[model samples]
Structures are given as C-alpha cells and as structure tokens.
Target chain A: MCGIVGLLVKTPALKARLGELMVPMLIGMTERGPDSAGLAVFTEPLATDERKISLYSGLTEEGADFNWLGLGHELKAHLGIEARMAVQGNHAVLTIGIAPEPVKRWIKEHHPRLHILSTGRAIDLYKDIGTPTEVAERYDFKHLTGTHLVGHTRMATESAVTPDRAHPFTAGEDFCLVHNGSLSNPYGVRRMLEPRGIKFETDNDTEAACRFLEWRLREGDDLETALQKGFAELDGFYTFLMGTTDKLALIRDPFACKPAVVAENDEYVAIASEFRSLAHLPDIKNAKVFEPAPEEMYVWTA
Target chain B: MDSLKFDLAEIPLRTVNTFLHQEAPGQGVRKVLITNPDGAHNIAVGLDFPVEIEIVGHAGYYAGGMNKQASITVTGSAGTGVAENMMSGRVHVKGFASNGAGASAHGGLLVIEGDAGLRCGISLKGGDIVVGGSVGSFSAFMAQAGRMVICGDAGDALGDSLYEAVLYVKGSIKSLGADARIEPMAEADLATVKALLAAAGPAFDQYAPQDFKRVASARSLYHWNADANQEY
Candidate 1:
C-alpha cells in the first residue's frame, strides 16, 4: 500500500507554512510506505510567458554536484533565452522565458539521465528514492511556500522504486496525481492513450492513470466530466488525489478498496490515506473529519 | 478500584498495553484513561479482563481487537478494523469508523455512534453490531450467525450471502446482495433491535424498534446444483 497526503490552505497566512505543515503529515505515513517519497507544491505563479521546470539530477553521474548554473548559461547561449535557475543539492527549478518544449528537448538531449520532475508556472516538484524524512531534508521541504501541495510515499508493488516512478505524476503542466490502490488494467489504459500520441514516462501503473486523467482535461473535458469518464474507463481500486493550479480534487473507485480520511477546518483542508497522518495538524480536533465516499468527487479551491 | 492513566504523548503504547496485559489486574485497576491516542494503531488490544478503557482521542487500526471481556470506548473516530475478530466484550466509538469496523467477530457488542465504512460486519461468526449512523457497501457479507441494527442508511450490497445472521435497518438500503431478501419483521426482530439499541446508547433511543426492516438470507447457496451448469 502507498500513502497519499494533501493539504490546501484556505487562509492566505497559512500559505507561508504550507510545506512546513506538510512535513509531519508526510512522515507520519512511514508505516504505510517506506521506500520513496515525493511532493508537488503549487506556489505563486510566474509571468504568463515564463515557465519553471523542476529537474532532478539524482541519477546523473555527478549526482549532488551537478552543474545547474552551467546548464543555464548553455541554454542562454544555445536557445538565445535567459534561463534563471535556483540550485538546490540535486534538484533545481529553472525558469525560462521561451516555450518549454524546446528547452525540455534540449535538456533531454544534453542530460539524458537528468529527470524532469515537473513544468508549470505554479508547480515545483521534488521526488527521490529515499524515506520521507530523508527526502524532505534533502529538498528542504519545510521552507517551501505554496497555497497547496500533494505528497506521496511509495511502497513499490507493481513497479520498481525509481525516482521517476515516484508519485505526483504529471502529464501536461500544472496537473499532478497520486494513487493509493493498484489498477488492474494499466496496460489496457496505456494502449488507449498511446494511440492518441501520449508518450508514457514509466511502466508504472499510477503514471498511466495520471496521464489518462490529465489528457482528458487537456481534451477540453471539465474536471468533473473527465473524472466521470475516469470512473467509467479506469477499472481498478483507486483513491486518486489530483492537484491543479487552483484546485485539489479527490475521487475513489466504485468499491473504494483503498482508505482515505479527510479533515477540513476554516484554515485548511487536509487528506491522507489514514487519520494517523493528519493527527498532528493544528486545530485538527475541531476540524470536520470524515471519510470520502466511493465514486464521489471532492474538490477544493485555493 | 483506582483508575490508571496512560498518556500516549509521553509513553509508548507498548507500556500501556503491557500494563494491561501483565499488571493492571494485579494492581486492582478497573479503569484506564489513555490520552493523546492520536490515531495510533492497537491502543488496547488482546485484553482478557473486564477493565474499562477510555481513549480520550482518536484511535488507529484495531483499537479493541481480540477482546475477551474488556469494554473499550473511543471518544473520537476509529480507524480500520476497530474491533475486528473480537471474541467477547464491548467496543464503542463515539464518532465514525473506517472500513471493516467489526469484521469476523465471534461474540461481543460493537457500537459505532456514527457511520461505518464498507464491509461493516463481514464474515461474522457470532457478534452483535449496532450502527447509530449509516453503513457502507457490503455490510455483513457471509455471516454465519449474529445480528446488526443500523439506524441510518446502508450502501450497496447489504448482506450479500448470509447464514442465520439478521440485520435491522431503520433507514434506506441501496441494494441487497444475492440470496438476501427483505422479509417482514417479526416480534423477535423488534425485540432484538430494542435490546441492541438500548445497549448502543441513549442517543440511539430516538430510533424506535418498529421503524427498522429485517434482512436475512434465502439460503439458496447452501446446496449446490451440479446439473445447472455453474449458474446461480
């Protein structure tokens, strides 16, 4: 079983402590998932023309000493675009002025081993192969400031424990999903999406679901409509938690084979696979704690 | 007898459970107060005594599992399998409960003051369950013997394949499983609901025994028909 946690702060003041508040929530699920940990946080958006790409150099040869500024300069020279990067250990968030397709392709061409974690105006993602505590310390998750975040701890069942295979899987941009239950027909869903030109990143089942839902959203289906289709086509036991630019959405399969508990107050809305992960939240005693029903869509806006 | 206190914030749950298992009885303790449970799993499990355990906060998985004579009470919500596989005693939750709330119990009274998630009393050998609120899908599947009193609605597939176990539901039932049918409630069913509701608590007293409907199995799957070509 994997662990999924999400926190959406309604009060603007609580946004400053988003990541700090989520650290305990993520670490609390250590018993459920102990292999790898990851999170996607939606921060203040950048300019309309600028898109930030979160890159992980953990698998690179140089590892922690990977040259992020050097890549920025190379991008400036090759693509004639000013790229500003915030270097953090093996992870970096690089902001580029031009469109992201060429820059992403260039990065893939030059640094094939470097994994692109996410790309969007509001999202900066970090995921790695380690325990939740180690991963949180490595990325300094406590210092991150955002309106909302989705975190995951992995207990590998259907796939290997690679950083790219870790959760908060992204599809187009600003859209991420974490799954708890296993999908019975991921390959069938893959065949359905591959013919439509959706290239998969990993053989993991959760990625297939993530891409399918995001592709539906990109195909002009509203969130609710796309999720209705997801309920129809995606055949498996899943409690999916998705995060977009301004919304956090959740849905369970028809059977709700997986577990999920939600706690909401005037200040924040927190979700976890179990109540243990959310026990440490402030004022949680007064929160409206409840379990989400099967085949029901729950959405919260920032 | 003096009541003992165990603060989970400062002490590990093992110490409390060990005390309950090893020394609480010898010390003449009849009551236990557990504070800051914080949804920790296995708060007071495997008790063979008649001591009363009061958990001040939420409890995690299997809070009162395998109980013999102990009476456990949680002031807040309980996680999955709160009183699963209980032999005898009483488990009470003041708030809602997660999946498989009272699964496969042999004997005891499991009370959820609020709702209970999917498969509330699956595979029950013999036990009594009183749900003050709704119960999710697949409640009381494949029960050998026991009874359940549901004050609120029930989700899909209530009592799929049952044996001698009866369910009294006051609210609507979404669907009934195969071989399960709604029959007229006799005087015995009403009396059972009355006794179970009174045992549940005063809050459940508002629900009258006559308001409930009885659901039981048709016993069609008791004997197989080989000549029918494997169709139900």
Candidate 2:
C-alpha cells in the first residue's frame, strides 16, 4: 500500500508555489503509508546544450556531506566535460554541458554505489526512508519551485523499506511514476525487459512498471497508447500517476480496487489517493472533484 | 436521544474512527454526525453496535464496511465497497456509489438513492440491496443468496452464475448471465418488492410492486458435466 499525490500547475503564476501547496497533500496521506517517501519535481528546463542528473549518495559511508565537488572534478577529468554540482540533503544534482547518455554510462562504470534517481532537462528526484513530513522537510520541499510534481508515501508491502525501493520511479527522461497497488506478474515483466537491456535498480513491482513504460515509449508508442496497452498486459490492481515534462497522466486498473480522487481548478490539477489530501487546496470548493472511472486515463498538461 | 457532532476538519479521521469504535451501545450516545467527510476512506468499519452515523458529505472507499448493527447514512456519494461484508443493520447512500457496493455482505439492508457502479452486489450472501438508479455491469455475479432490487436499468451480465438469490429490476436489463433467466412474478414476489420499496423510504413511492421483473438461476449448470465444461 502507498499514497500518491500529484499536482500540475496550469497557471504560470502559481508555478513557484508548487512545493508549498504539495506539502500538505503529501502529509495528509501519512496514515496510509509511513515507511518512506519520494518526490519528483519538474521545474524550468535546462538550456538546450545542458542536462541535469539527480543522484542519491546516502549509500556512501560519507553520508549527506559526501564529496560532490570532488565527484564533479572527477567527472570533468574522466569525460573532459565541464560540470557543476549542488548538494541538497542526500541528493546531488549535476548539470553538465554535454549529452546525458555518455554521462550516465560514465557514472555507471565509475560510481556504481551512487543511484541515479532521475536524468532530464527539468526533473529532479529525491527519496528517503522517513515519514512524509520528515522527508519533505529534509529535502526543503516547501522552498522548492516547480511547474509540476509527483510524490509518494510507501508502506513497503512488497519490497524492503530503502531509498531505492521508494516510489516516483523514473522511466524515460523527465518521465516518472508512482503506484498505489502491487502488480501480480512483475517478475515476468522484468524477465521480458531485462533481455531488452532495460536495467532495474530494485526488485520492486513499480520499477518493472516504470521500465515497461519506458520500453513502450522507446518502441514509439505515445503515453496514452502505452497506458492503454498496459491495461491489457499488466495483471494487477493499480492506480498509477505518471509525470512527464509537459503532462501529468493518471490511470487505474479495470477493477479499480485502489481509491483515487482527482480535483481540477483553473489554477491547477491535483490527484491523490483520497479527497482529504485535496480538500485544503485553494478554491477547492469550486474545483471539480470526481473519481476517475475504471480503465480510464485522464491527463493534465502544463 | 443523545447525539454527538464531529467536524473532520478540526480532527483527523483516525481519531474520530477510534472514538466510534470504542463507544459501546446503550451507553449514552445514540447518534453521530460527521461533517466534512470529504471522501475519506473507511469512515465507519467493523461497527457492531446499534447506533446511527450520519456522514454529511461524500465518503471514500469501504464506508460502513463490515457493519453489524449500526445504521450508517451518507448524505453524498459513496466510494467503492460501501457496506461490504455487512452482517446486519442498514446503510443508506443519498447519492451515487462506486463499484462493489455491498459486496459479499451476509445480512443487512443497503439502499442507494442514485446510480450504483459496476459489480454492485457481487458474492452477496443474504443482504438486501436496493438501487434507485441504474447499476453497472456484472452485478450480483456469483451471488450465493440474497435479494437485489434495482429501480432503474441494469447493466450487462446481471446475476452471472447466480444461485438461490432473487433479483428484481424495474427497468431494462442489458443482458443476463449464462445460468440466470427471467421468471414469472407471483403474489409472494409482489409482497417482497413492496416491502423492500417501503424499506427504501418515500423516494420509491412511484414504483408499483408490479413494475419489477424477477430473475433467478436456471439450475441447468448446477452439476458440471464434461460436455457443459466446453461452453465455459
């Protein structure tokens, strides 16, 4: 079991206050999930010549003050590309004036202990094992500014309670997902994706779903088509909230076992496992609140 | 009569549910008014005593689930699995309900004033369900015993693989399940419908007892045969 909250700000004026509005939404679901929490925020895109890679370093013995500056120097030497780095909590965002693919390969070979949580022009991912409130504060979520965000609080029903096992699992560039229910045939899906060169960091079912969507997008299917195919291929009860650079998409399984409520206003579109998480939003009384039907996909774009 | 009012905006749902769970019957409080529910799941589950719980706004999944003797009422729409596995007492929803309402309930009365979503009475044992509006597809599937009355149209595959239970629909049925078929209404059937309508309150006053059509199991597939297995 887990709780998922997503917000897509339609009004550009409210973009900078995304994190302030999202804090309560994430904390409201603390009772549903208390093990760990993760969030993915999409802010302004990087310059066309640059890319950003968010990496988690808690696994290192150095803890939160790990040598990110030294790592940046090493990357510059190893790849012969200039890079800048900023450390927040246990995560470090590295912006490099180079393509992302080779940089990702360099990191995989050099720093196997570091986990690349996200890599995109706009997305920054942070996750840790703590209460939603604690994790949100630790990452300075209230001060973070973004156009859209996806967050999750996990209960650890199927996987160990570790940072990597936490949700908002990233797929393609600037694409991430948070799931509420367990998948039945994740191992089978993993086996299918492994041979296609899709790497997995954890044995969690949501990772398999994330990788599947990435593979589908790689195969030239749009997000809507991939989700429609997922309903036929994936066997489980799930409510998935997926995020991309421009869109926030939601879909539920045919049975619709998990609870989900969506509220939309002229300012923003919000989704959560329950309405209580959304009740405190601005102009909520005027927002349209409705439960998304089974096998239906709803999308909000920025 | 003593009544207590709780505003969910001022308190957490867990705290309110804990208080409701600890309260004993006939101790003093006979009614509870919960305001600003705002679609929180599992509002009043496992309630065994005879008390009245009136929720002022929309409720989330599993509202009043596993109810025994409590009479719970929702002023707005209810999420999935309302009154699920209920053993006794009553649950009333003033607005629409999501899927699996009253699923696997053994005994009780669940009344929905508006439309019910898919699989409304799946695996019902003995509970009596009344829907004022249309019910979605695959309702009453694998129902062992119970009674379901739908005042509006019924969606596809109504009463699939049903046994012993009786279904009464005042409007059209999209289709019947494999082992279920329509039956002739008798004097006792009219009496049953009339009593169920009365129990549902005055909203159903215009529905005459004769308006319902009875549906039951065909009994042809009771014992599985090698040839019959091919059809499945």
Candidate 3:
C-alpha cells in the first residue's frame, strides 16, 4: 500500500505544464496511499557556485508561521553568505552561494526541529503529512515547472506517518528514491552503510535504500552499476523509482511483488504503480504503454 | 435493439455495476458499452447475464472477475487480475495485462493480445488462457486442471508445482518449475492448441499447432519421498 509516480518531459515546452499534469496523477493514487504525500521536482540548474536546500518547518515549534526572512538574515550575518528564499506554507527553498553542508549544520544547531528535505542545485522538494490533494495544494504543486519530478503517496506500513518519514527520500545531493514495497533486510543495509560514515535521518526502510543508492553514486558507480549492486545487496519486494538531475530510473524486484506501469511517448515518460494515475494524460491512447519487467532497469533521460 | 452505453466519466461505477446486476438481465440489453474506463477497478465484474461488454479504454484490477455467461472485451490494457475466478464465457484484452491476469479461474476462456504479467494463472482450479504475447514468471503455478496456450515466450518457472493443468508455449522458456517438464506434444495437445488459438481470435491465427511444446507435471512432487533427505 504505497503509490509511486514519476514524470519526465522530453519536450522542453511541456515542462511548464509538468506539475499541472502531475497533480491529477498524484491525487488518483490517494486510495493506494492516503496518509502522506510528497514529491521532488528537478527544475533548471542553478549557477555553478550556488546550491539550494529544501527546508520543512512542519515539525518545528512555529509551524507555518516560521520566520523565513529572519533565517535568511541570520545566514548573512552568521555565515557571511546571502540566502535567497521562496517560501510556501511550511515549506521553503533557500538558495545560497555556499556549500550546503555548513548551512545544514547551522540550521541543525540553531533550528534543531527544522527538517531538511533535500539539498541540490536542480532539485526542490516538498513533502508533508496530509492527503495527496492536501499536500499538493499546500505546496501549490500545480504551479511548479520542471523537466522532471518524482512523487509518492505513502500508506505507512513500515514506519510512523510523520512529515519527515513521508517519501521521495533523498540522500547525498540531487538524488531521491521512492519505494512501493517493504524491505526485509533494511537493518542489514543500515548496518552496512552506517560503517561507511553514512548518517540516517529516519528509521523508515525507504531511507536506507535512498542513502544506499546515493552513496554508490557518490562512489562513482554509474546508476546502472549501482543498481546491479542493489540487486545483490537489497532483499525485498520493491518497485523503486529513482530521480536524478537528468534521469528517471525504475526497477522492480526479482518477483515484482510491487507493480509499476510505464507510459512513454515522444513528449514525455510517465511511470506509476497503476494505470489509474496516467489515464488523464494527453494523447494517452497513442502512448507506448508497457510494464517494466522484473529486475530490469528502465532509465529515461530528461 | 441498440447497445447500452455507460460513460464512466459522468456516471459512477456503482451505478453501472448496479445496472448490470439488477436491471440488465430484464431489459434485454445484449450489448453494454463502457466508455473511458480509465483503469477503474472492478468494471463489469461478476456478471451473470451473457451480455456483451465492450470497455473502450484501459481497465484496472478485476475488470471481469467471477463472470458467468458474459463476453467482455477491453479495447486497452487491463490491470492485475483481469478475469480472476471466471466461471464461464470469454474475457479478452486488446493490450497488455498486469500481474495475475486470469488467476484461479474455474471455466471459460481468457485471451490477451499482448503480454501478461507474473503469476497469470496461479492456483487455478480450472480454466483456459491464451496469451498472444509473453507471460511472466510462475505462470500456471499449482493449476489443478484445464489448459493454457502461450503464443510467446514464458518467464522463469513456467508452471511450478503443477497439478493436471497443461501448458503449450510457442517460444522459449526461461525455466520450468519443479516437476513441470516439457513433454512430447501428443496429437491431443496439438489439437488443443489449434482449438484454443482459433478461439483466441484472428491475432493468434499465425501460430501453428505444431509450433508449440507441451509442459506438464512430472508428478515427482506428488508424494513425499521419505528416503530423499529434503531434496526434490
């Protein structure tokens, strides 16, 4: 009982309407996952010296009324860097001209409860504890513009239904993964990754998968090779959909215990756990729709 | 004698299903047209009236389950369990089908013009399936009776731990399950493939009867081997 959705527009013109098209797709899976929903959209890249961090204040004491401007000024006075921000409800994207590690450390030290969703040059993530429609409306997902995005609706079988535990789990930078099945050996994976200086944010099993794959990417293994290692190390019934700055990759477990359907055309590639989420797309009748085979990686470039 | 039409976009699924269950038999609506199926689950399920259902678009899980004396056709793909536990009549899909396409069916015929997903006919009591495209792993697992004709390749463990149900495949098999072996196709097996292919419609007209190989149980696992220490 989880739902995963990913969309990457091949035609640059279609990027403007990307979020608008994805709203219905996310809402359609509300039945499969009604507890919480989230997504990470990959927009145009930032300047070479700049990076952006997606911050969530839902777990904070101030909630939606958190003073984002004060945080920007604090960064300027304390860290000697100006931070430009775009705030929406409890979520905000803070773009800065410094590495995200120290900025993240500052936020962790000062605003301990503020959850960092993601930090990258091209990705802006938003997730919260609500229905898919509520979360989409909360973040105004319909107005988002990007080349691609990965979204998820979770029913919370393996972890508590908290804002931080909701999916599109990110690790390292500019990478995220959403899962639709449970892992049998998440503790084993965590034990393996923890020894290598990787830190975990939540006890959710999907985080382990997200961090494991990203750690591999950081180690210079290409996406396909890392996934091959994943096939050997990860043991579970999973259909994991991963998002990078330039690609959207999907894979099902050997048994395909979880489902994924891919619909592709000249303009875009859309993936969902079921066809219900994709029936509203334009020219869906002519789309080359098919089910990705088990243990096979299908990667689409944006 | 016009066909009955139901646009799922405007009318709720419960309304359409209610009509088929309560009012359709008495009204003599021989044909039912469902428009914009949009991967909606349980469309035209549990029918008893021998009515002809034409789904104009993709249907979700269990599109035509537990059917009796009905003919259902999906113009697009079908989700998991397209025709599970069907009692009689025919259910056909013009496009690909998700996992467990015709699982545990009792009688009647199920046809897929495209690929069928994993465990397509698991735990089948009886029924017949004809897949024009490939079938995923573990198809026809533990099937007790009836027949299956796959015009394309089969994934790993084609018919593991089978029981009486026979399988005919035209293409390569990734692997066969325990006790399920490719036996010499007898004259009866060829005739069965011929009849099933014809029943599956024109899309299967190209597959000759002799082109298929028969897979059935070796009956090795039928009884417990007390002397063989946990090895099959």
Please provide, for model 1 over B28-120, each residue's C-alpha lDDT reduced to its tens digit, 9 standing for 90 to 100.
788999999998999899999889999998899999998889999999999999899999999999999998988999999999999999999
lDDT of 1 by residue, A113-201 (tens): 99999999999999988899999999999988899999999898999998999988998999999999899999999999999999998
Candidate topping DockQ: 3
Global fold similarity of model 1 (TM-score): 0.99
Model 2: per-residue lDDT, tens digit, A64-142?
Answer: 8778888888988888988888788578999989889999888888878788999999999999999999999988888
lDDT of 2: 0.89
Model 2 root-mean-square deviation: 3.3
Ranking by TM-score: 3, 1, 2
Q: How many steric clashes does model 3 contain?
A: 0
lDDT score at residue A271, model 1, on the 0-100 scale? 97
Question: By descending DockQ, how would the candidates be arranged?
Answer: 3, 1, 2
DockQ of 3: 0.89
lDDT of 3 by residue, B67-163 (tens): 8999999999999999999999999999999999889999999999999999998877788999999999999999989899999999999899999
Which one wins by DockQ: 1 or 2? Answer: 1
Stretches off by above 4 angstroms in model 2 are B1-3, B11-31, B40-52, B66-70, B87-89, B114-118, B132-138, B151-157, B169-178, B182-214, B224-232
Q: Where does candidate 2 clash, by residue pair?
A: none
TM-score of 2: 0.87
